[model samples]
Target: MTTAPASGFQTRRIVESAAACSGAVVAGLSLMVPLDPRMMGNTSALEVSLTVLNAPRSAAAGAMLAVVAAVYAMIFGARVAWCASFVAASVLLICAIAISGPVSSGSLAIVNFIECVTAGILVGALAAATLRRPGVGTAYTVGILCGIVIGDQLQMPEAGAAMSRWRWLYAAAPPLWLSVLAVVLLGVGLYWHRDQAPIVSESTVISNVPLVPILAGALMLTVVTTTSEWTARYDFGAAGLVCEILVLAGAALVAALLLPGQDGTLILLATATASAGSAVVAVPHPRWSWSLTLAALALGFLAGRLRPAPLVAAGLTTALAVYAVLTCGIAHTYLLLPVIGCTATAFVLGYAFGAAVPHTVSGMVLGIVILVAPCMIVALRGHENGTVGYSPNWYRDPNGTEGLLPPIVAVAVTLGCTLGILLLRQLRPVTAGHIRRLPGRALGGKFA
Candidate 1:
């Protein structure tokens, strides 16, 4: 008997499924806009700091909640998860309208904070439960996160007094927009995600990576991204923001071509660059040496081809950390240069990791950890330092960022890169070119 030809209907269904996932991502992004503290007129700096930390905690919390919701949905039905997600979206809309009306007190900000945490959990759970493909699910989660980065670049004149004519609409527009998107998302969920189940991929079975390395790597990223944003604001003209993105994309292309090897080894080197540069920048009055920093990062990305990449990278990271400690009173003009160098390393490493993981939810988890850990680590550091009330305690930093942010970034980078390389080895193809799914090892085949 001849094998049946593939059905056009099934092909159409798959296409529809992918479209639904992308649209659902837009809805999730809209849901997150109200949670940003900049919309609230208090403690913007603290909120930014807290934001760094909140992302990872929020992800882990939401992951647990998603598991619970998924189990419950399995027991009951997908409709329940759909309802929970819708209600959360509605509540976010209501809160946005209510908060935009007038200033009640400082405590009202607390309401917004709670809304963010609660909504984050629900959205994450919904994303986890409804999506099947790793690529689609990851797209949804990452879109939800792009809100802050995208918002900062937009030119939305605050709903000010001049727009008093459309004042009500201006205040209500965002929530209204989000509410409509939520309805659309719910409809999509019911139609497409009703009985979908996740498929485990071969890469997931062999690659049991840990979060320990992410924590360390994240610190390096946090310092690099945050400082770069702050400093870039000073250099990039009105068009500077656009330039920043374009430049990074260009750097990504260069790094990808310049470096080729295991994904984990590349990530390890990226973190090492962070470790090295942060040490120099954290000091006072050093010669501005972005060339040195970029050279270090370039070496890192290229180092992955070597058999002893991990050892060399770890030794480099340690050496940089100690060197920075020794050169405690150094400062420089092109401070943003090293950050740019390290940031490029991290970004390239991230996309490479993305390509390496098999299309699975485990891939989604790893992506989020790499992206969010740096912010969370730095946020914790900010709390530990208690508002930088006096002269900076470290980095001889008049701005106080060095004292609170650098150490956290350094520690996170050093550990994350090392551990990531260790995990990468086990995930290597079993033979010269074929892939094998390690049985009973769905969670990074080794640890699980």
Candidate 2:
């Protein structure tokens, strides 16, 4: 039998997948600068602490703009939107470097806000462009996760120190300039292959984006983010009840606006819980955590390729792994437990999210929000309020043992929610007319 030549459609898919993966890597690397704790916490002056530390708040504002950017990409075209976003982000980074020494902390914070907003637009565009194509979508997701890890590694003090005089090439980080150059080249390549469009189902396309719902979702994210940051920074008279209420209300609003029906609800809850649980297993030991994370990501990628069914299975496993990691012992003292727990959490959550990603604009927004929300909420609570697990107490040598109660409760609650949703779906009688016709299924893949 003769091997058939690849069709034009297959070629298009290949090109688009490569472009999407490249764009996602750049976006992830760009995003890390704003999200970096060292960058956020390190300030020029002692008195201007508040502005610098509140970078996450600016990131939240950026998330709001991300919604607008995603809509713009859908309306105009992903290529145009992505190029514009890349230029904007570049300008902001350049401006940030120019003003690093002379500008006030407040001005620096503003720069951070704009940079984050531009980066968010880039990310939103990439997601909107690729999420409709199965192969491209998987590539984008995996590329982003890997890029985040690589970016973090590159920003480490040792990596910067190795650069010596070359380190001064960029104000933020030595490799950042290289990342920008790579993005520019990638954009040029994308423009060159602009006509090579991937096969996308007509049903997945959003002719007229839902403005009201999108705006509502953006507002909710903004409020939740702002409230979370404020609550984290300063103690309210009574544990910031109003702020907590706002955060919860905002999350609920997002679910209402972005996630519509039963399936949507299931996706939202499952993703959020898994994300929160996965945040806990931060292997504090120097280089081990990074290596373990990469290995876990690789494992997850393989698992995702297998396309596990009943998507919640992976998420539930992730929660259980996290609980086990925490309850085992101090991660530093009992290295085996953390290694196992962290690997399990990353592998399972990776599979859960990678396989279950929906193929709609609203679903795209939900994915981005799920990634951001858990980190924000955990940051809001901090190690003091409770251990959502990401924020370790020790600055230099974190043991990863303190504050176990909260994460245990969180994972347990998530597990309960998953079971409850499954029970509800099974018990409730289905009617054809009662079902809402969403753009795509909650879980995307053979199982969905």
Top-TM-score structure, candidate number: 2
Q: lDDT, candidate 1, residue 340?
A: 42
lDDT of 1 by residue, 180-248 (tens): 555556555556555644333335522433333233223333443443433322433335434433333
RMSD of each: 13.2, 6.7
Q: Give the residue spans of candidate 2 off by over 4 A.
A: 1-18, 29-42, 45-48, 88-105, 147-174, 193-207, 212-216, 219-227, 230-275, 286-292, 310-325, 336-338, 374-377, 380-401, 416-448
State the local distance difference test value for candidate 2. Answer: 0.50
Candidate 2 TM-score versus the reference: 0.70
Q: What does the lDDT read for residue 289 in candidate 1?
A: 37
Question: What count of clashes does model 2 give?
Answer: 0
* Alpha-carbon lDDT, every model: 0.38, 0.50
Instruction: Give lDDT tens digits, candidate 2, residues 117-145.
Output: 76667676666566655777677677666
Which candidate has the highest lDDT of all?
2
Q: Model 1: runs farther than 4 Å from truth?
A: 1-39, 42-63, 70-84, 103-110, 129-131, 134-138, 141-179, 191-346, 349-353, 356-363, 366-376, 380-416, 423-448
